[model samples]
Target: MTPFLEFDLRMIIVDRLEKSYGGRTALKGISFRVHRGEVLGLLGPNGAGKTTTMKILTGLIPATGGRASVAGFDVHEQSLEVRRRIGYLPEHPPLYREMTVRGFLRFVAELRGVPRSKRSAKVDRAIEQCGLAEVAGRIVGRLSKGYRQRVGLAQAIVHDPEVLILDEPTVGLDPKQIVDIRSLVKGFGGERTVILSTHILPEVTMTCQRVVIITRGSIVAEDSIANLTGRGEMGERMAITVARDLDGVASTLAGIPGVIGVDRAPGEPPTYHVSVERGFSGKELLSAAVVQSGCGLLEMKTVPETLEDVFLDLITEEHGVAA
Candidate 1:
Protein backbone atom coordinates (compact mmCIF):
# COMPACT_ATOMS: atom_id res chain seq x y z
CA MET A 1 0.00 0.00 0.00
CA THR A 2 1.10 3.55 -0.79
CA PRO A 3 1.00 6.40 1.73
CA PHE A 4 -0.33 9.89 1.15
CA LEU A 5 2.02 12.81 1.35
CA GLU A 6 1.32 16.51 1.71
CA PHE A 7 3.63 19.44 0.94
CA ASP A 8 3.37 23.07 1.93
CA LEU A 9 3.49 25.75 -0.75
CA ARG A 10 5.94 28.61 -1.01
CA MET A 11 4.51 31.84 0.37
CA ILE A 12 7.11 34.47 -0.46
CA ILE A 13 9.91 34.40 -3.00
CA VAL A 14 12.49 37.18 -3.38
CA ASP A 15 15.63 37.26 -5.48
CA ARG A 16 18.36 39.87 -6.03
CA LEU A 17 16.08 42.65 -4.79
CA GLU A 18 17.61 46.12 -4.80
CA LYS A 19 16.20 49.44 -3.64
CA SER A 20 17.74 52.90 -3.37
CA TYR A 21 16.61 56.25 -2.05
CA GLY A 22 18.29 59.51 -3.08
CA GLY A 23 21.31 57.59 -4.35
CA ARG A 24 21.63 55.84 -0.99
CA THR A 25 21.20 52.09 -1.28
CA ALA A 26 18.72 50.75 1.26
CA LEU A 27 18.63 47.14 0.17
CA LYS A 28 21.82 46.06 -1.48
CA GLY A 29 20.64 43.14 -3.58
CA ILE A 30 18.93 41.33 -0.72
CA SER A 31 17.32 37.94 -1.34
CA PHE A 32 15.45 35.26 0.62
CA ARG A 33 12.48 32.88 0.37
CA VAL A 34 9.80 32.10 2.94
CA HIS A 35 7.87 28.82 2.95
CA ARG A 36 4.17 28.42 3.68
CA GLY A 37 3.06 27.35 7.15
CA GLU A 38 6.17 28.90 8.68
CA VAL A 39 6.76 32.19 10.44
CA LEU A 40 9.84 33.91 9.01
CA GLY A 41 11.34 36.62 11.21
CA LEU A 42 12.90 39.66 9.56
CA LEU A 43 15.46 40.65 12.20
CA GLY A 44 17.99 43.47 12.02
CA PRO A 45 19.02 46.60 13.79
CA ASN A 46 17.68 49.98 12.67
CA GLY A 47 18.49 51.03 9.06
CA ALA A 48 19.18 47.49 7.91
CA GLY A 49 16.59 47.75 5.04
CA LYS A 50 14.03 45.55 6.77
CA THR A 51 11.26 48.01 5.99
CA THR A 52 12.48 48.53 2.44
CA THR A 53 12.48 44.82 1.74
CA MET A 54 9.03 44.40 3.28
CA LYS A 55 7.61 47.28 1.30
CA ILE A 56 8.89 45.85 -1.94
CA LEU A 57 7.49 42.44 -1.15
CA THR A 58 4.04 43.77 -0.23
CA GLY A 59 3.79 45.96 -3.35
CA LEU A 60 3.64 49.11 -1.23
CA ILE A 61 6.66 50.33 -3.23
CA PRO A 62 8.42 49.13 -6.34
CA ALA A 63 11.90 47.69 -6.15
CA THR A 64 14.62 49.45 -8.07
CA GLY A 65 15.61 46.12 -9.59
CA GLY A 66 15.08 42.36 -9.16
CA ARG A 67 11.99 40.21 -8.82
CA ALA A 68 9.60 38.98 -6.13
CA SER A 69 6.41 36.96 -5.82
CA VAL A 70 3.80 36.57 -3.08
CA ALA A 71 1.68 33.47 -2.83
CA GLY A 72 2.52 32.45 -6.46
CA PHE A 73 1.59 35.87 -7.89
CA ASP A 74 4.21 38.24 -9.31
CA VAL A 75 4.38 41.36 -7.22
CA HIS A 76 5.19 43.58 -10.18
CA GLU A 77 2.58 42.25 -12.55
CA GLN A 78 -0.28 40.96 -10.37
CA SER A 79 -0.10 43.28 -7.42
CA LEU A 80 -3.84 43.44 -6.85
CA GLU A 81 -4.10 39.67 -6.73
CA VAL A 82 -1.10 39.55 -4.46
CA ARG A 83 -2.71 42.11 -2.21
CA ARG A 84 -5.88 40.05 -2.09
CA ARG A 85 -3.91 37.00 -0.95
CA ILE A 86 -1.89 38.76 1.71
CA GLY A 87 -2.78 40.80 4.83
CA TYR A 88 -0.22 43.47 5.77
CA LEU A 89 0.07 44.86 9.31
CA PRO A 90 2.41 47.80 8.92
CA GLU A 91 4.41 49.21 11.82
CA HIS A 92 2.04 52.17 12.04
CA PRO A 93 -1.30 50.62 11.20
CA PRO A 94 -3.77 52.89 9.43
CA LEU A 95 -7.04 53.13 11.39
CA TYR A 96 -10.02 55.39 10.94
CA ARG A 97 -10.47 57.11 14.27
CA GLU A 98 -14.03 58.33 13.70
CA MET A 99 -15.51 54.90 13.07
CA THR A 100 -16.73 52.37 15.61
CA VAL A 101 -14.81 49.08 15.87
CA ARG A 102 -17.57 47.08 14.20
CA GLY A 103 -18.11 49.75 11.55
CA PHE A 104 -14.40 49.97 10.87
CA LEU A 105 -14.00 46.23 10.49
CA ARG A 106 -17.12 46.04 8.33
CA PHE A 107 -15.70 48.75 6.11
CA VAL A 108 -12.40 46.95 5.90
CA ALA A 109 -14.14 43.68 5.12
CA GLU A 110 -15.93 45.30 2.24
CA LEU A 111 -12.76 47.02 1.07
CA ARG A 112 -10.91 43.72 1.05
CA GLY A 113 -13.63 42.27 -1.19
CA VAL A 114 -15.47 39.96 1.15
CA PRO A 115 -18.81 38.99 -0.34
CA ARG A 116 -21.65 41.26 0.62
CA SER A 117 -23.64 38.50 2.33
CA LYS A 118 -20.63 37.21 4.23
CA ARG A 119 -19.21 40.56 5.32
CA SER A 120 -21.05 40.61 8.64
CA ALA A 121 -20.09 37.05 9.46
CA LYS A 122 -16.49 37.76 8.47
CA VAL A 123 -16.42 40.91 10.60
CA ASP A 124 -17.87 39.06 13.57
CA ARG A 125 -15.35 36.23 13.16
CA ALA A 126 -12.43 38.62 12.93
CA ILE A 127 -13.57 40.54 15.99
CA GLU A 128 -14.00 37.34 17.95
CA GLN A 129 -10.63 35.94 16.87
CA CYS A 130 -8.87 39.18 17.81
CA GLY A 131 -10.63 39.45 21.19
CA LEU A 132 -12.44 42.62 20.19
CA ALA A 133 -16.00 41.53 20.95
CA GLU A 134 -16.32 43.70 24.07
CA VAL A 135 -15.09 46.80 22.30
CA ALA A 136 -16.89 46.08 19.06
CA GLY A 137 -19.31 48.98 19.42
CA ARG A 138 -16.88 51.58 20.81
CA ILE A 139 -15.30 54.30 18.67
CA VAL A 140 -11.78 53.30 17.64
CA GLY A 141 -10.40 56.68 18.79
CA ARG A 142 -11.53 56.00 22.36
CA LEU A 143 -9.93 52.56 22.55
CA SER A 144 -6.61 51.98 24.26
CA LYS A 145 -3.42 51.40 22.32
CA GLY A 146 -3.62 47.67 22.93
CA TYR A 147 -7.19 47.48 21.67
CA ARG A 148 -6.30 49.66 18.70
CA GLN A 149 -3.49 47.27 17.88
CA ARG A 150 -5.99 44.43 17.95
CA VAL A 151 -8.26 46.46 15.69
CA GLY A 152 -5.35 46.82 13.31
CA LEU A 153 -4.86 43.09 13.38
CA ALA A 154 -8.60 42.53 12.90
CA GLN A 155 -8.62 44.66 9.78
CA ALA A 156 -5.67 42.79 8.39
CA ILE A 157 -7.35 39.39 8.80
CA VAL A 158 -10.87 40.39 7.79
CA HIS A 159 -10.47 38.87 4.38
CA ASP A 160 -8.86 35.65 5.60
CA PRO A 161 -5.79 36.01 3.40
CA GLU A 162 -3.31 33.19 3.03
CA VAL A 163 -0.29 35.26 4.09
CA LEU A 164 0.16 37.81 6.91
CA ILE A 165 2.97 40.35 6.82
CA LEU A 166 3.30 41.81 10.32
CA ASP A 167 5.68 44.64 11.20
CA GLU A 168 6.20 45.09 14.93
CA PRO A 169 2.85 43.59 15.87
CA THR A 170 3.55 43.95 19.58
CA VAL A 171 4.73 47.54 19.52
CA GLY A 172 3.40 49.93 22.19
CA LEU A 173 1.33 47.28 23.93
CA ASP A 174 1.45 46.26 27.57
CA PRO A 175 3.01 42.98 28.61
CA LYS A 176 -0.35 41.20 28.68
CA GLN A 177 -1.36 42.51 25.28
CA ILE A 178 2.02 41.58 23.86
CA VAL A 179 1.58 38.06 25.11
CA ASP A 180 -1.95 37.87 23.67
CA ILE A 181 -0.89 39.13 20.23
CA ARG A 182 2.15 36.87 20.16
CA SER A 183 -0.01 33.90 21.03
CA LEU A 184 -2.33 34.76 18.15
CA VAL A 185 0.62 35.12 15.79
CA LYS A 186 2.03 31.78 16.87
CA GLY A 187 -1.35 30.19 16.21
CA PHE A 188 -0.99 31.06 12.53
CA GLY A 189 2.49 29.58 12.20
CA GLY A 190 1.52 26.20 10.73
CA GLU A 191 -1.58 27.40 8.86
CA ARG A 192 -0.44 30.51 6.99
CA THR A 193 2.93 31.99 6.18
CA VAL A 194 3.77 34.86 8.55
CA ILE A 195 6.51 37.37 7.79
CA LEU A 196 7.10 39.06 11.14
CA SER A 197 9.39 42.07 11.53
CA THR A 198 10.01 42.95 15.14
CA HIS A 199 12.63 44.41 17.50
CA ILE A 200 11.39 42.23 20.35
CA LEU A 201 13.89 39.38 20.45
CA PRO A 202 11.74 37.19 22.67
CA GLU A 203 8.82 37.40 20.23
CA VAL A 204 10.95 35.90 17.50
CA THR A 205 12.34 33.25 19.81
CA MET A 206 8.89 32.32 20.99
CA THR A 207 6.80 32.52 17.80
CA CYS A 208 8.86 32.32 14.64
CA GLN A 209 9.76 29.07 12.92
CA ARG A 210 12.69 30.47 10.92
CA VAL A 211 14.79 33.61 11.35
CA VAL A 212 16.50 35.79 8.74
CA ILE A 213 19.15 38.10 10.16
CA ILE A 214 20.15 41.06 8.03
CA THR A 215 23.03 43.45 8.74
CA ARG A 216 24.26 46.41 6.70
CA GLY A 217 21.56 45.86 4.05
CA SER A 218 22.46 42.24 3.43
CA ILE A 219 21.48 38.81 4.73
CA VAL A 220 24.09 37.67 7.22
CA ALA A 221 22.25 34.58 8.44
CA GLU A 222 19.07 32.55 7.78
CA ASP A 223 18.10 29.38 9.60
CA SER A 224 15.62 27.79 11.95
CA ILE A 225 15.62 29.23 15.49
CA ALA A 226 16.70 25.91 16.93
CA ASN A 227 19.60 25.43 14.51
CA LEU A 228 20.68 29.07 14.63
CA THR A 229 21.09 29.03 18.42
CA GLY A 230 22.05 25.39 18.69
CA ARG A 231 25.30 24.09 20.19
CA GLY A 232 27.18 24.22 16.87
CA GLU A 233 26.81 27.92 16.04
CA MET A 234 27.33 29.00 19.66
CA GLY A 235 29.53 26.66 21.64
CA GLU A 236 27.98 25.47 24.89
CA ARG A 237 28.61 27.43 28.10
CA MET A 238 29.53 25.18 31.02
CA ALA A 239 29.80 26.47 34.59
CA ILE A 240 31.88 24.44 37.02
CA THR A 241 32.13 25.33 40.74
CA VAL A 242 34.97 23.69 42.56
CA ALA A 243 36.85 24.01 45.83
CA ARG A 244 40.17 25.13 44.40
CA ASP A 245 42.20 28.20 43.44
CA LEU A 246 41.37 29.99 40.14
CA ASP A 247 44.85 29.65 38.63
CA GLY A 248 45.58 28.32 35.11
CA VAL A 249 41.94 27.18 34.56
CA ALA A 250 41.59 29.33 31.47
CA SER A 251 44.83 28.06 29.96
CA THR A 252 44.17 24.48 31.02
CA LEU A 253 40.71 24.40 29.39
CA ALA A 254 42.03 26.23 26.34
CA GLY A 255 44.58 23.43 26.00
CA ILE A 256 41.69 20.97 25.56
CA PRO A 257 41.00 20.11 21.90
CA GLY A 258 37.50 21.61 21.68
CA VAL A 259 37.51 24.03 24.63
CA ILE A 260 37.55 27.64 23.44
CA GLY A 261 37.92 29.97 26.46
CA VAL A 262 37.63 29.68 30.21
CA ASP A 263 36.94 32.61 32.52
CA ARG A 264 36.85 32.68 36.33
CA ALA A 265 33.51 33.83 37.70
CA PRO A 266 33.45 35.87 40.90
CA GLY A 267 31.73 33.99 43.74
CA GLU A 268 32.44 32.57 47.19
CA PRO A 269 33.93 29.16 46.30
CA PRO A 270 35.00 30.19 42.77
CA THR A 271 33.59 28.93 39.44
CA TYR A 272 34.96 28.64 35.90
CA HIS A 273 32.63 29.26 32.97
CA VAL A 274 34.07 27.51 29.92
CA SER A 275 33.09 27.92 26.29
CA VAL A 276 33.43 24.86 24.11
CA GLU A 277 35.56 25.81 21.11
CA ARG A 278 34.55 23.14 18.63
CA GLY A 279 31.10 21.50 18.27
CA PHE A 280 31.90 18.72 20.69
CA SER A 281 29.54 17.81 23.54
CA GLY A 282 31.01 19.51 26.61
CA LYS A 283 28.85 17.58 29.07
CA GLU A 284 30.57 14.19 28.68
CA LEU A 285 34.11 15.48 28.15
CA LEU A 286 33.98 18.00 31.04
CA SER A 287 32.49 15.50 33.47
CA ALA A 288 35.05 12.82 32.60
CA ALA A 289 38.03 15.18 32.77
CA VAL A 290 36.87 16.81 36.00
CA VAL A 291 36.52 13.41 37.67
CA GLN A 292 39.96 12.28 36.54
CA SER A 293 41.65 15.50 37.66
CA GLY A 294 42.58 15.96 41.33
CA CYS A 295 40.49 19.12 41.56
CA GLY A 296 37.21 18.65 43.40
CA LEU A 297 34.64 19.42 40.65
CA LEU A 298 31.82 20.46 42.98
CA GLU A 299 29.27 21.47 40.38
CA MET A 300 29.02 21.68 36.55
CA LYS A 301 26.19 22.98 34.40
CA THR A 302 25.64 23.69 30.68
CA VAL A 303 24.06 26.93 29.47
CA PRO A 304 22.06 26.70 26.28
CA GLU A 305 22.56 29.30 23.58
CA THR A 306 19.61 31.64 22.99
CA LEU A 307 18.46 33.96 20.19
CA GLU A 308 19.64 36.93 22.20
CA ASP A 309 23.18 35.57 22.19
CA VAL A 310 23.03 34.95 18.45
CA PHE A 311 21.70 38.46 17.75
CA LEU A 312 24.33 40.05 19.98
CA ASP A 313 27.11 38.00 18.41
CA LEU A 314 26.07 38.97 14.87
CA ILE A 315 25.71 42.68 15.54
CA THR A 316 28.86 42.83 17.67
CA GLU A 317 30.83 41.23 14.83
CA GLU A 318 29.38 43.72 12.36
CA HIS A 319 30.27 46.67 14.57
CA GLY A 320 33.71 45.27 15.21
CA VAL A 321 34.35 44.90 11.50
CA ALA A 322 33.02 48.38 10.77
CA ALA A 323 35.17 49.88 13.50
Candidate 2:
Protein backbone atom coordinates (compact mmCIF):
# COMPACT_ATOMS: atom_id res chain seq x y z
CA MET A 1 0.00 0.00 0.00
CA THR A 2 1.16 3.52 -0.79
CA PRO A 3 1.74 5.60 2.33
CA PHE A 4 -0.26 8.85 2.66
CA LEU A 5 2.91 10.93 2.88
CA GLU A 6 4.58 9.02 0.05
CA PHE A 7 2.38 10.85 -2.47
CA ASP A 8 2.21 14.07 -0.52
CA LEU A 9 5.03 16.54 0.32
CA ARG A 10 6.45 14.81 3.36
CA MET A 11 10.09 13.84 3.08
CA ILE A 12 9.87 10.78 5.34
CA ILE A 13 7.19 8.58 6.93
CA VAL A 14 7.16 5.75 9.51
CA ASP A 15 3.92 3.90 10.25
CA ARG A 16 3.61 1.32 13.03
CA LEU A 17 7.36 0.62 12.97
CA GLU A 18 8.50 -2.10 15.35
CA LYS A 19 11.84 -3.72 16.28
CA SER A 20 13.01 -6.36 18.76
CA TYR A 21 16.12 -8.27 19.81
CA GLY A 22 15.20 -11.80 20.82
CA GLY A 23 12.61 -11.24 23.61
CA ARG A 24 13.04 -7.49 24.18
CA THR A 25 11.16 -5.09 21.93
CA ALA A 26 12.94 -1.85 21.13
CA LEU A 27 10.19 0.04 19.32
CA LYS A 28 6.50 -0.70 19.75
CA GLY A 29 4.49 0.59 16.82
CA ILE A 30 6.00 4.09 16.97
CA SER A 31 5.23 6.37 14.05
CA PHE A 32 5.89 9.94 12.87
CA ARG A 33 6.49 12.01 9.74
CA VAL A 34 8.83 14.77 8.61
CA HIS A 35 7.95 17.37 6.01
CA ARG A 36 10.36 18.60 3.40
CA GLY A 37 12.58 21.46 4.64
CA GLU A 38 11.28 20.99 8.17
CA VAL A 39 13.50 20.17 11.18
CA LEU A 40 11.95 17.54 13.42
CA GLY A 41 13.41 16.14 16.65
CA LEU A 42 13.02 12.59 17.96
CA LEU A 43 13.45 13.28 21.67
CA GLY A 44 13.69 10.73 24.46
CA PRO A 45 15.79 9.68 27.40
CA ASN A 46 18.62 7.12 27.22
CA GLY A 47 17.42 3.67 26.00
CA ALA A 48 14.11 5.10 24.71
CA GLY A 49 14.23 3.52 21.21
CA LYS A 50 15.42 6.78 19.60
CA THR A 51 18.53 5.19 18.13
CA THR A 52 16.49 2.21 16.91
CA THR A 53 14.20 4.54 15.00
CA MET A 54 17.15 6.29 13.36
CA LYS A 55 18.79 3.04 12.30
CA ILE A 56 15.61 1.85 10.60
CA LEU A 57 15.15 5.16 8.81
CA THR A 58 18.78 5.19 7.67
CA GLY A 59 18.56 1.56 6.43
CA LEU A 60 21.28 0.45 8.84
CA ILE A 61 18.83 -2.08 10.36
CA PRO A 62 15.53 -3.65 9.43
CA ALA A 63 12.25 -3.10 11.21
CA THR A 64 10.60 -6.36 12.16
CA GLY A 65 7.16 -4.98 11.29
CA GLY A 66 5.37 -1.93 9.78
CA ARG A 67 6.43 0.41 7.00
CA ALA A 68 8.89 3.30 6.61
CA SER A 69 9.95 5.31 3.61
CA VAL A 70 12.30 8.13 2.76
CA ALA A 71 11.91 10.23 -0.36
CA GLY A 72 9.06 7.83 -1.31
CA PHE A 73 11.45 4.84 -1.33
CA ASP A 74 10.80 1.88 0.95
CA VAL A 75 13.54 1.46 3.59
CA HIS A 76 13.32 -2.34 3.51
CA GLU A 77 13.02 -3.02 -0.21
CA GLN A 78 14.80 0.11 -1.50
CA SER A 79 17.57 0.61 1.04
CA LEU A 80 20.15 1.57 -1.57
CA GLU A 81 17.91 4.34 -2.86
CA VAL A 82 17.11 5.44 0.69
CA ARG A 83 20.82 5.56 1.57
CA ARG A 84 21.56 7.55 -1.55
CA ARG A 85 19.01 10.16 -0.42
CA ILE A 86 20.07 10.39 3.24
CA GLY A 87 23.27 11.63 4.92
CA TYR A 88 23.39 10.19 8.43
CA LEU A 89 25.73 10.98 11.36
CA PRO A 90 25.51 8.31 14.00
CA GLU A 91 26.16 8.97 17.71
CA HIS A 92 29.78 7.86 17.42
CA PRO A 93 31.16 9.02 14.11
CA PRO A 94 32.50 6.38 11.71
CA LEU A 95 35.90 7.92 10.94
CA TYR A 96 39.10 6.56 9.42
CA ARG A 97 41.49 7.93 12.02
CA GLU A 98 44.54 7.25 9.80
CA MET A 99 43.39 9.45 6.92
CA THR A 100 43.78 13.22 6.46
CA VAL A 101 40.59 15.30 6.88
CA ARG A 102 40.39 16.09 3.15
CA GLY A 103 41.41 12.58 2.11
CA PHE A 104 38.77 11.06 4.41
CA LEU A 105 36.00 13.21 2.96
CA ARG A 106 37.18 12.48 -0.57
CA PHE A 107 37.01 8.78 0.24
CA VAL A 108 33.49 9.17 1.72
CA ALA A 109 32.30 11.04 -1.36
CA GLU A 110 33.70 8.26 -3.55
CA LEU A 111 31.95 5.62 -1.42
CA ARG A 112 28.65 7.51 -1.75
CA GLY A 113 28.98 7.48 -5.59
CA VAL A 114 29.94 11.14 -6.11
CA PRO A 115 30.93 11.72 -9.75
CA ARG A 116 34.70 12.07 -10.24
CA SER A 117 34.18 15.49 -11.87
CA LYS A 118 32.31 16.98 -8.85
CA ARG A 119 33.87 15.04 -5.93
CA SER A 120 36.58 17.64 -5.16
CA ALA A 121 34.11 20.52 -5.17
CA LYS A 122 31.71 18.59 -2.92
CA VAL A 123 34.47 17.63 -0.50
CA ASP A 124 35.75 21.23 -0.34
CA ARG A 125 32.26 22.58 0.32
CA ALA A 126 31.70 20.13 3.13
CA ILE A 127 35.05 21.00 4.68
CA GLU A 128 34.28 24.72 4.56
CA GLN A 129 30.77 24.34 5.95
CA CYS A 130 32.02 22.26 8.87
CA GLY A 131 34.94 24.63 9.58
CA LEU A 132 37.55 21.94 8.96
CA ALA A 133 39.74 23.83 6.47
CA GLU A 134 42.30 24.65 9.17
CA VAL A 135 42.75 20.93 9.75
CA ALA A 136 42.16 19.64 6.22
CA GLY A 137 45.74 18.30 6.12
CA ARG A 138 45.75 17.04 9.71
CA ILE A 139 45.48 13.32 10.43
CA VAL A 140 42.15 12.38 11.97
CA GLY A 141 43.81 10.28 14.72
CA ARG A 142 45.96 13.16 15.96
CA LEU A 143 43.25 15.86 15.95
CA SER A 144 41.56 17.13 19.08
CA LYS A 145 38.19 15.74 20.09
CA GLY A 146 36.49 18.86 18.77
CA TYR A 147 38.36 18.69 15.47
CA ARG A 148 37.43 15.03 15.00
CA GLN A 149 33.79 15.98 15.48
CA ARG A 150 34.15 18.58 12.72
CA VAL A 151 35.50 15.88 10.45
CA GLY A 152 32.47 13.74 11.22
CA LEU A 153 30.10 16.54 10.24
CA ALA A 154 32.02 17.30 7.04
CA GLN A 155 31.76 13.71 5.86
CA ALA A 156 28.03 13.60 6.59
CA ILE A 157 27.39 16.59 4.29
CA VAL A 158 30.04 15.65 1.75
CA HIS A 159 27.44 13.77 -0.24
CA ASP A 160 24.80 16.51 0.01
CA PRO A 161 21.90 14.07 0.16
CA GLU A 162 18.26 15.16 0.13
CA VAL A 163 17.73 14.18 3.75
CA LEU A 164 20.09 14.52 6.77
CA ILE A 165 19.69 12.41 9.88
CA LEU A 166 21.88 13.19 12.92
CA ASP A 167 21.84 10.90 15.94
CA GLU A 168 23.11 12.75 19.04
CA PRO A 169 25.30 15.05 16.97
CA THR A 170 26.59 16.97 19.96
CA VAL A 171 27.28 14.19 22.42
CA GLY A 172 30.66 14.11 24.22
CA LEU A 173 31.53 17.68 23.28
CA ASP A 174 32.39 20.53 25.63
CA PRO A 175 30.12 23.56 25.93
CA LYS A 176 31.90 25.56 23.20
CA GLN A 177 31.97 22.69 20.70
CA ILE A 178 28.32 22.06 21.43
CA VAL A 179 27.53 25.66 20.49
CA ASP A 180 29.62 25.49 17.30
CA ILE A 181 28.07 22.20 16.12
CA ARG A 182 24.58 23.55 16.90
CA SER A 183 25.25 26.50 14.60
CA LEU A 184 26.19 24.14 11.76
CA VAL A 185 23.14 21.95 12.40
CA LYS A 186 20.90 25.04 12.36
CA GLY A 187 22.30 26.06 9.00
CA PHE A 188 21.51 22.66 7.47
CA GLY A 189 17.82 22.57 8.52
CA GLY A 190 15.88 24.62 5.93
CA GLU A 191 17.94 23.49 2.95
CA ARG A 192 16.86 19.84 3.35
CA THR A 193 14.74 17.61 5.55
CA VAL A 194 16.69 17.10 8.83
CA ILE A 195 15.80 14.66 11.58
CA LEU A 196 17.65 15.45 14.84
CA SER A 197 17.49 12.49 17.19
CA THR A 198 18.71 13.45 20.66
CA HIS A 199 17.90 13.09 24.33
CA ILE A 200 18.83 16.62 25.29
CA LEU A 201 15.90 19.01 25.76
CA PRO A 202 17.93 22.14 24.93
CA GLU A 203 18.95 20.66 21.59
CA VAL A 204 15.29 20.38 20.53
CA THR A 205 14.24 23.74 22.02
CA MET A 206 16.97 25.63 20.21
CA THR A 207 16.91 24.10 16.70
CA CYS A 208 13.82 21.99 15.96
CA GLN A 209 10.46 23.34 14.76
CA ARG A 210 8.63 20.28 16.15
CA VAL A 211 9.37 17.34 18.42
CA VAL A 212 8.35 13.67 18.78
CA ILE A 213 8.74 12.66 22.42
CA ILE A 214 9.07 8.92 23.03
CA THR A 215 9.69 6.67 26.02
CA ARG A 216 9.75 2.94 26.76
CA GLY A 217 9.50 2.05 23.06
CA SER A 218 6.33 4.08 22.62
CA ILE A 219 5.60 7.61 21.43
CA VAL A 220 4.04 9.80 24.12
CA ALA A 221 3.63 13.14 22.35
CA GLU A 222 4.37 14.94 19.11
CA ASP A 223 3.79 18.65 18.34
CA SER A 224 5.42 22.00 17.73
CA ILE A 225 7.24 23.47 20.72
CA ALA A 226 4.87 26.41 20.79
CA ASN A 227 1.78 24.20 20.94
CA LEU A 228 3.26 21.99 23.63
CA THR A 229 4.31 24.95 25.78
CA GLY A 230 1.23 27.17 25.47
CA ARG A 231 -1.75 24.84 24.98
CA GLY A 232 -0.88 21.46 26.44
CA GLU A 233 -1.69 20.09 29.87
CA MET A 234 0.14 22.91 31.67
CA GLY A 235 -2.20 25.38 29.91
CA GLU A 236 -1.89 29.19 30.08
CA ARG A 237 -0.27 30.58 33.22
CA MET A 238 0.38 34.03 34.68
CA ALA A 239 2.71 35.45 37.29
CA ILE A 240 1.05 37.78 39.76
CA THR A 241 2.13 39.82 42.77
CA VAL A 242 0.04 41.51 45.38
CA ALA A 243 0.86 44.56 47.52
CA ARG A 244 -0.35 42.98 50.80
CA ASP A 245 -0.49 39.40 51.94
CA LEU A 246 -4.08 39.28 53.05
CA ASP A 247 -5.28 36.30 55.08
CA GLY A 248 -7.70 35.11 52.40
CA VAL A 249 -5.64 36.31 49.41
CA ALA A 250 -4.84 32.81 48.07
CA SER A 251 -8.42 31.66 48.42
CA THR A 252 -9.70 34.88 46.77
CA LEU A 253 -7.73 34.31 43.56
CA ALA A 254 -8.55 30.62 43.61
CA GLY A 255 -12.23 31.56 43.72
CA ILE A 256 -11.96 33.21 40.28
CA PRO A 257 -13.75 31.40 37.46
CA GLY A 258 -11.50 29.29 35.20
CA VAL A 259 -8.56 29.47 37.58
CA ILE A 260 -7.13 25.98 37.85
CA GLY A 261 -4.57 26.53 40.60
CA VAL A 262 -2.78 29.39 42.34
CA ASP A 263 0.69 28.88 43.78
CA ARG A 264 2.63 31.26 46.04
CA ALA A 265 6.27 32.01 45.42
CA PRO A 266 8.81 33.19 47.96
CA GLY A 267 8.95 37.00 48.04
CA GLU A 268 8.23 40.14 50.07
CA PRO A 269 4.91 41.13 48.48
CA PRO A 270 3.79 37.51 47.96
CA THR A 271 3.92 36.47 44.30
CA TYR A 272 1.40 33.98 42.98
CA HIS A 273 1.64 31.66 39.98
CA VAL A 274 -1.82 31.37 38.48
CA SER A 275 -2.51 28.51 36.04
CA VAL A 276 -5.72 28.41 34.05
CA GLU A 277 -7.47 25.88 31.85
CA ARG A 278 -7.33 25.95 28.07
CA GLY A 279 -9.52 28.55 26.22
CA PHE A 280 -9.96 30.61 29.40
CA SER A 281 -9.72 34.36 28.84
CA GLY A 282 -8.77 35.04 32.44
CA LYS A 283 -6.36 38.00 32.12
CA GLU A 284 -8.88 40.74 32.84
CA LEU A 285 -10.89 38.41 35.05
CA LEU A 286 -7.84 37.67 37.19
CA SER A 287 -7.01 41.36 37.54
CA ALA A 288 -10.57 42.21 38.58
CA ALA A 289 -10.73 39.26 40.93
CA VAL A 290 -7.55 40.42 42.67
CA VAL A 291 -8.77 43.98 43.19
CA GLN A 292 -12.27 43.00 44.26
CA SER A 293 -10.88 40.81 47.02
CA GLY A 294 -9.45 43.96 48.69
CA CYS A 295 -5.83 43.17 47.68
CA GLY A 296 -3.46 45.33 45.68
CA LEU A 297 -2.60 43.89 42.29
CA LEU A 298 0.99 44.93 42.00
CA GLU A 299 1.86 43.00 38.86
CA MET A 300 0.45 40.52 36.32
CA LYS A 301 2.35 38.92 33.46
CA THR A 302 1.93 35.80 31.33
CA VAL A 303 4.46 33.00 31.80
CA PRO A 304 4.81 30.49 29.00
CA GLU A 305 5.36 26.91 30.06
CA THR A 306 8.92 25.60 29.73
CA LEU A 307 9.72 22.59 27.55
CA GLU A 308 11.45 20.88 30.45
CA ASP A 309 8.25 21.12 32.47
CA VAL A 310 6.11 19.86 29.63
CA PHE A 311 8.49 17.03 28.78
CA LEU A 312 8.69 15.82 32.34
CA ASP A 313 4.97 16.27 32.87
CA LEU A 314 4.02 14.26 29.79
CA ILE A 315 6.50 11.45 30.47
CA THR A 316 5.53 11.20 34.12
CA GLU A 317 1.86 11.40 33.30
CA GLU A 318 2.17 8.64 30.72
CA HIS A 319 4.11 6.25 32.94
CA GLY A 320 2.47 7.18 36.27
CA VAL A 321 5.95 7.62 37.74
CA ALA A 322 8.67 10.20 38.16
CA ALA A 323 10.54 11.01 34.98
Candidate topping lDDT: 2
lDDT of each: 0.84, 0.88
List, residue by residue over 1-323, the lDDT tens digit for candidate 2: 45334366788998999999899999999989899988998899899999999999998899999999998889988888889889988889889999999999999999999999999999999998999889999899999988887888888889998899999999989999999998888888788899998889999988899999999899988999888776658677888998888787788788888889989988788899988887778789789888887778899998878888888987887778533
Worst 10 residues of 2 by lDDT: 1-10
Pairs clashing in candidate 2?
none
Off by over 4 Å in 2: 1-7, 266-269, 292-295, 321-323
Q: How many angstroms is residue 123 displaced in model 1 relative to the true structure, after the best TM-score fit?
A: 0.5
For each candidate, what TM-score against the reference?
0.91, 0.91
What CA RMSD would you report for each candidate? 4.5, 2.5
Runs in model 1 lying further than 4 Å from the true structure: 1-8, 266-269, 279-295
Root mean square deviation (Cα) for candidate 2: 2.5
